[model samples]
Target: MSVVVSFKVRREVKELMDKYRDRVNWAEELRRFVEEKIRQLRAEENLAEILEELRKAGWSVPKGFSVKSVREDRDSR
Candidate 1:
């Protein structure tokens, strides 16, 4: 399913957008931009929730744990 979204803009802004519309699909461009931003924001929120859950479970790194270990772990993947 799909929905329509509309917004108001200044006359100059609309004029500039119309001018660029001749060279690009501005509506599709805005849709992609909006979708990417939405995904990024949702990911951030999910990460924050996961961190909170970890904190609630008293999860913590030991004093001996270092960024080197973290980097190595990531590189292993």
Candidate 2:
């Protein structure tokens, strides 16, 4: 099943799209873009929830812990 999505665009935008419409599947491209954005938004929301949980649990990094230091430590091992 498919749904129709209709939106108004500037005349120039419409014209530009029409010019390349035959060269591209615009609707499919738009669908891909929308799907990727949706995934990104959901990931961000999940991360926010995790951060809130961590805050409630008083999670904190030790003063000596740093990404660079950790990388060096791992490299030395």
In candidate 2 the C-alpha lDDT for residue 63 amounts to 81
Residue-wise C-alpha lDDT for candidate 1, range 1-77, written one tens digit per residue? 99999989999999999888889898899899999999999999999999999999999988868987988999999
Each model's lDDT comes to: 0.94, 0.94
The candidate scoring highest on TM-score is 2
For candidate 2, the per-residue lDDT at 23 reads 100
Q: Estimate each model's TM-score.
A: 0.77, 0.80
Best by lDDT: 2
Off by over 4 Å in 2: 67-77
In candidate 2, the residue pairs with backbone N, CA or C atoms under 3 Å apart (3 or more residues apart, or in different chains) clash, namely none
lDDT of 1: 0.94
